[model samples]
Target chain A: MSSSSAAPTAKPPMRDALVAAAFRLFLDRGYEQTTVDDIVALAGVGRRSFFRYFPSKEDVVFPDHERCLTDMTAFLAGGEDEEHDPVARVCDAARMVLRMYAENPTFSVQRYRLTRRVPGLRAYELSVVWRYERALAEYLRSRFAGQTDGTLRADVIAAAVVAAHNNALRSWLRSDGEGDAGTLVDHALGHVQRAFGRPADAPVRAVPVRALPDEGDERPEDVVVLVSRRDAPVWRVVQEWEAALGRA
Target chain B: MSSSSAAPTAKPPMRDALVAAAFRLFLDRGYEQTTVDDIVALAGVGRRSFFRYFPSKEDVVFPDHERCLTDMTAFLAGGEDEEHDPVARVCDAARMVLRMYAENPTFSVQRYRLTRRVPGLRAYELSVVWRYERALAEYLRSRFAGQTDGTLRADVIAAAVVAAHNNALRSWLRSDGEGDAGTLVDHALGHVQRAFGRPADAPVRAVPVRALPDEGDERPEDVVVLVSRRDAPVWRVVQEWEAALGRA
Candidate 1:
């Protein structure tokens, strides 16, 4: 076969190298103890190269987040097909994010731990999460434009999706890579889908219809009343409903 | 009245004084350039007293989030009668948080600016937010014990409520304290309420009825099929729906 499968030499990208080095140093020396100098030295890269790859030490820990944000923005922007469904498009976008973490499980795990211990990294991670929610909200706003209260609905949906993803990811990380995280994410997203979508029709219920009073009759049953309290007790509200229905 | 009225000599809480001082210093010297010593000195409180009020410098910049979290937890835990309707209770709990911020608009705005510019304060704020979500999710899990896939639903609901609050709060903050934030929060929570709760019996098209096929009746319309594609073109999907309904 003329050695058709000759070995190919490939080198890690500067960004990836820096990220790997940062993760290692963060784990070995603790996030606060580790400095940019130590990371550049460990990665065998120049200070300028390090700076080019990351704006600061914290940036080294999360190199791909900006790229992921951009990719998610693009995906949401490209979602013009209604057949794909807003819910499905959102799920697919979330899957893209999960796949990004899965692609670098070690780095993600380490980053997760570092974020837990380091306040600065945790804030940075939150900003990244906020960006994700913003992108999702923007996409949803377009999809549900005509619906009443569309902006609020979009914000809620985006937040729910991100929370599901975070919850599933946290569980996977806590288990030390023992579970099927992808499946868990799907299950989580399913919860989100059901929350906003309509439920399947329930079994039909047949009940006898009641006669209404004559329009000119001036009795209490002749007039219907509706009362609502936003913060009233549920049972009290139910009682009010029953009373208003003349069944109390 | 013979001068029987008591004098109005009560000042803002020591904590509030420290927060005001810290905020002023943050504005003047930048958040990073300010120190705990300077804040206590400006607030005219001893270092021990400052520690008694706030555990750390970053703590002074935030509202009493810990107190709010505790109140929320207590409110959620006290849901003896309304345990079945967690959605309502969760909304109420979230409103409590919103009200806390609204009560102190000046401090809230200052803290918001500091959080935006200071990474450490921002992380502390995120941690507080995460705690709120966790408390909400726990309450929801308890309420939805018998339901299938309850945990995920609970988590998503918590996330949605938090997101709505944040969205409304951010809008209020960015607008320089203009507008009715309480009304906005109510509108936001209403979106969440409708998402998980049943819709009102507003008039809508009646669902199509499907009759069961009798034996030996091989009508194509009797056996309905549904095919959904993740990335199908919207027009194609709509056309398929129309075809299935015999509209085209």
Candidate 2:
């Protein structure tokens, strides 16, 4: 209710101040003990200002998530390239959030610890994560609309992208955000991409196909065979067929 | 606060009474409007009994999820069968939850609608879903321990299973819990099994080898190559390979 604190109601400065003050209080006095009054007083802002920036004490803890989710949705939405692999595109969209976490390693790590300790905040974080996953799924579902098991493929790939992203993100957070999160996320996404990417076309190109000539005129066409390790990516098989049709 | 209400402190009856009363009040007067005292008074149970059964008003709205999650964890933990396909094992485990929802269609549907309206409850439900997914992931990771990309594969498969199950479950609930959820879930899980099952090992086995035929090699080993549509299930490919191998 202070007049001087209310003077600077212009967003970024006041919002950032409240967030800084809130996190400091959350770290020093713990999340439950820290009140809105405490955050506003520390930030030299009014209660109204705090409310303007964040609706609740819990909201202050996760200030960037809304923006991050919006950014991710936009990333997925803008992906209209015909040649872009849906799986890879989704994984790239997931990386947008990872980049958000990577931008503020210290704050992200601190928030991660706080959220883990507070059940309500943890639940809120899960909801946010779900939103990101849904955005990815919706995009993939549109791309795979009429294909066989398209819906299943969309849901699974989306879930896989989210899981892989979190696996990397959580691993980094568990290490107190010490390592290269970009690399971890890339490595994680790579696993998903190889497993479920482009059906079977891309990977099949990497495998060598043989045209073995047949002896008898009755069986005049050459026998085309592909021999790969038992664990080759599905794409390798898919690509070979595409190649076979092209040759025929 | 009434003495008559405080008379019956026996656990199970008291807990069930509280849940029943709370739901009735929640339906009649909305969740936020109904207080703990109102619930206890209606149930004819002590406030202590209400607290014992549920920690909060939000907890009452979601009475069975905790028990269901625990049951799912137990189901996954008991997977000692070497003969069961890991993917099928998980699909069966997911069925336990579907059965829980199917047992009380109206209640489940009501809860689903309520959760969609309430942000906090939706968040709580997401957390519960995450726990279910974690249980599935843990079971799969244990089964695929040393294989390449085992952890990623396990996590992805678990996520896919959970996603597919939810897709079916939600579609059923969206129809006001009409139709057979069991059949819907079976169809959904069938999609997942077809895409990622291990009937012929993983999807990596169909890569081609570079075998240009020697011009004079007469009637060289009959190159038995099985060609199927690119969209064929991994299991079908594996079965075909198995049958081919058998014939050979």
TM-score of chain A of 1: 0.75
Give me the displacement of residue A17 in model 2, in angstroms: 3.0
TM-score of chain A of each: 0.75, 0.80
lDDT of 2 by residue, A1-248 (tens): 11222355433777888899999999999998889999999999889988877878878888877776766777777776678888888988888888878988999999999999988788778878888888998999899988876777788789988998898898899999998999999999987886678764322322223445566645433333444333345455545544664564
Per-residue lDDT tens digits for candidate 2, residues B59-90, read 88877677777767777777856766888888
Candidate 1 residue pairs in clash (backbone atoms < 3 Å): none
Question: How much lDDT does candidate 1 score?
Answer: 0.70
RMSD of each: 11.2, 8.5
Compare the candidates by DockQ and give the number of the best one. Answer: 2
Off by over 4 Å in 1: A1-11, A80-84, A117-120, A142-147, A197-248, B1-12, B27-34, B80-84, B113-121, B145-147, B173-180, B197-216, B219-248
